[model samples]
Target: MGTFGRRLLLAVDAKGYGGADAVTQRQLQEAIRRLLSEAAAASGLEWERWETQVGGDSVFAVLPEGASEPDLVDTFMRHLDAGLRAFNHGRVRAAWLRLRAVVHFGSASPGAIGFVGRAPVEVGRMLDSAALKAALAAAPDACLALAVSPTVFNDVISDAYTTIRAQEFREVVVAEKEHTGRAWIRVPGYDARALDLGVPSGAGREGATGGGEVPDVRPPSAPTAPGDTVVQVINGTVHAPGSVFGISK
Candidate 1:
């Protein structure tokens, strides 16, 4: 007997978690737990009222009904950004906690271990999207990368009264494994408009790069292998050398 209803679903994952040593990974997991708790509290979300699940280096959270989307954006996201900034301020690059997040709204039900629903599955795909992973990798300075499903984008982010300006989000196509769909992306503190359309330096294919053109700030590094593609920052825009389509930003 599980109840069903419309809920706000969120998933957050740490980038490069697999590459870390065991001890460091454990520390990161704890940090993420604390970060989520702080973010939820700052956003006025009650911890006890929501269903939460933790896996490896990721978290899946379901917000109670009537949770304000705009508030989640303005408060939770901002607090998350601030928290990560503070955490990274004195740390080296290897210890910095970069994250990818996905937000959606859909039906869900409480299960034995956590919430079981299509919303969780969909948000997980968005979190694991290549577009998001590449975007975060390209912008080394960015602390968090976010993908919002079309439903959330249309209903919440695009609303006139939302604190998150619609212009801050850029449309992108997520093509990873079995998931192929459109999602909106935003990096809280960085200039989302300045990101280039490219995959991680070695990712095999190109996807949509939708934004204005900017100069590459950094030169392309030498590829490790003959067929390995190099990522080029042209005027401030990032580009994958072997990409079939080039989208400027």
Candidate 2:
């Protein structure tokens, strides 16, 4: 027997982070744990329990009923985002984590296998699939901010911020240390080196090793690419940077 409800499973990892493999992995794991605990308390969600897996780099938990409201999910997302930023600020430059977070909601069986439900394992798998595609399309230094399944997107996401959807996985070349492998995704006008090495040239595109793993080194380019600029909108109208970027609550 399985419960029929919107079960959410979130699994997160960073892209192109450069730090000790073990330490960086641990940091991500610990951050998730802390975030879950804090969010549960603040959101008043009845989180049953959580488990640390894969050397503290990943986690899984159950959300209490009534925690799936769109407004509440959005609020929780903002909270998680803020908490992650704070966690990175305390780490070294090389240790900063730009994460790929995937959230999946569906029916789940809490107990051991054999129950017919979308359990955390399946939800986590979906997130990983989405993250892999997003990460591959992302610039080397670019990390996926967050990903929500259609269930969450349609049900929980507010229609405020427009989502930039990347196409499904498309293979590409990745240059890495002592080896080269085929990667995927095509982010138009993306420059990995510019973001990672402060170089204008976009080179050495590669799949990310686990969080905090060192990437292949390349000579830094001379020129610096201009930052990507975009228009900010508010209340159904475009706003100035001061009004948008600097708007305070």
Candidate 3:
């Protein structure tokens, strides 16, 4: 809320994978719900508008005026990432459970009178289709990726990471091009070192300065009623009672 018109458009998405079978069923709904609740709490920033769409796996929030900007983004991501891991502990397959996150930053503003334009929607679409999946594959641990728009790239990509080559994706290029429509430069404190890639708070894991191990994965179980999966989750681990049945048979 400074005289500066700069704002960050953060788009995020998460997915669950690998169970006895698609039907054996991981606690997808419960995981997503906890993700949203934790993100809202973690950000501690108001939203111009926030909503859950594209099923329950994804949630969108627009940072309101006076939000911490880059710092808020880092906080929100760390909060959600830690929450998911904590949510997965103690289950029969807890070690195998993981989540993927993709965040894109851009110049954004609410449509006059409060309608969302193509801005947030386009980012969400990219996240849904590619970035989210890529994060899962590229992330060494169940890591979170916070991508900066080219508009702010020079500001955030450190001299070290900037000189180093990074994988290229057409979607990333396109989004960056779109964001340059408005004149802007990177803001301070928006560099790669600022990214909090470590584990979540109080999760009992070591600091995430370096990446962690990649857990083993099994296929999802075959089809079963959602109601039949009695998801009991505490401290981030989901417990599905044995009667829940349909596990990868």
| Whole-model lDDT values for every prediction | 0.66, 0.41, 0.37
**What's the C-alpha lDDT at position 201 in model 1?**
35
User: Of models 1 and 2, which has the larger TM-score?
Assistant: 1
Question: How do all models score by TM-score?
Answer: 0.75, 0.51, 0.47
Quantify how close model 1 is to the true structure by its C-alpha RMSD in Å.
12.2
- Clashes in model 1: which pairs? 215-234, 215-235, 215-236, 216-233, 216-234, 216-235, 216-236
In angstroms, how far off is 128's CA in candidate 1?
Answer: 0.7
Worst lDDT run of 10 residues, candidate 1, spans 240-249
- Which scores higher on lDDT, 1 or 3? 1
TM-score of 1: 0.75
Per-residue alpha-carbon lDDT of candidate 2 for residues 1-249, written as tens digits (9 for 90 to 100) = 455665555555545443548867676667666775676556555444432233234444444445554523455555666676677765675666555555566675444422235435344433344334444344543323444544454334333332322232232222322332222222223432222222123222322332232343322532111232111111222111111111111
**Model 2, total clashes:** 0
